[model samples]
Target: MRKYGIADTTFSRVDMGKIAYKIIRDEDDEAEIIRYTVPGIKDLPVAAKRLIDEGCDGVITLGWVGKTMLDKYSYLATSIGLIIVQILTSKHVIDVTIHEDEADSEEKLKEIAIDRTSKHARNLVKLVKEGKNALTKYAGKGLRQGFRDAGEID
Candidate 1:
């Protein structure tokens, strides 16, 4: 059986890791799912890297960024760290983040987190089961996870 990793942050208002774990478990019963929770978004990179080193086929990292400028910079740095981890391990680390400003209300934020985490979790299954090219057909199709697809440009 294949193994997948989920790295999530406690700073997130929503329980994205639980949402993702449920989706992955429900979608693919045969695969093993390992979860690692950190205190904040900046710590996700190392957590994901550790999971990958522990033999996960791929990793899903979930984080929540505030609306502050400092949060933006921190998110950027965290993104770069995740990229470096992927490059070093040659593994797929899917970053799923939600900015607090994206939603107008707390309920909406939860909805976005659930939608994004669920979609990315399924994508992780597809990627591991089929291969990297599994999602290529949707490429340039303007597909989105948390919101409605933008659709293809005419």
Candidate 2:
């Protein structure tokens, strides 16, 4: 395996190397970094909590939000679901990655999914900063469900 290094930092391919490096230099000493990797859409809340319990400062979730070839059953819900789960976990998360792909065409089908996912991701981050679980109400429902709750900004 190829080993990559920066200054005195060295990383092995099989490790969460870059993240570990960042965590070490993170300004927030109270922060914990959590990464979630899954094969399918399942038990998102449980996954989020496990990372939080493990002292995760944030979460980077990897999974197939939708398949590019499939236009019908595949949708952005898988990505949106995990984000909502993070809302209920705690307010300690510093960042979250839903691992989605950009749309390939300008057709309505692709536009809808891409737009919804982008909007939800942005809103979820905002709600998280506000310390609220407003997005959880639409968990498992996908981006088409329009799950967003932005409370008063103070």
Candidate 3:
């Protein structure tokens, strides 16, 4: 009976899960948006599938991973997120990504962390209310083309 889905894990930069919940429960006017946040990406695909099964119109992901892995596994993690979004999109699910900077040490990182977090969070709330946005608005279409998911999204 819900219109949207939320999924996420814990990270240092920003609380993507928390933000998603606030957007869905507080900002969103839709009476049937179902919000959920878990410990990590482990629950993402299952959650996405569940949304699809439940007839959710869209999905939002909020999660964080260290930017230290940028040269390492970050690509893989991003790829996985993209694949899930794509799969869900192919099935007609509206996807959105709200990228959050998890790099807490770098000065620019910190600034971006705070700035993007606020911007994304506030924008998310506004978008949810208007029911007119998706993650592809930031991360591009090929990699993300369905509901909204914030990978390291604060």
**How does each model score on TM-score?**
0.97, 0.34, 0.52
Best by TM-score: 1
Instruction: Give one digit per residue, the lDDT tens place, for model 1 in 60-130.
Output: 99999999999999999999999999999998899999999998999999889999999999998889888
Best by lDDT: 1
What lDDT score goes with residue 137 in model 1? 92
- Rate residue 39 of model 3 by lDDT: 56
lDDT score of residue 121 within candidate 1? 93
Q: What are the clashing pairs of model 2?
A: 32-56, 32-57, 33-57
lDDT of all predictions: 0.94, 0.37, 0.50
Give the alpha carbon lDDT tens digit for every residue of 27-109 in model 3. 55553666566555445656666765776655555444544546226535654764766575654332233343433355555
> Candidate 1: which stretches are off by over 4 Å?
none
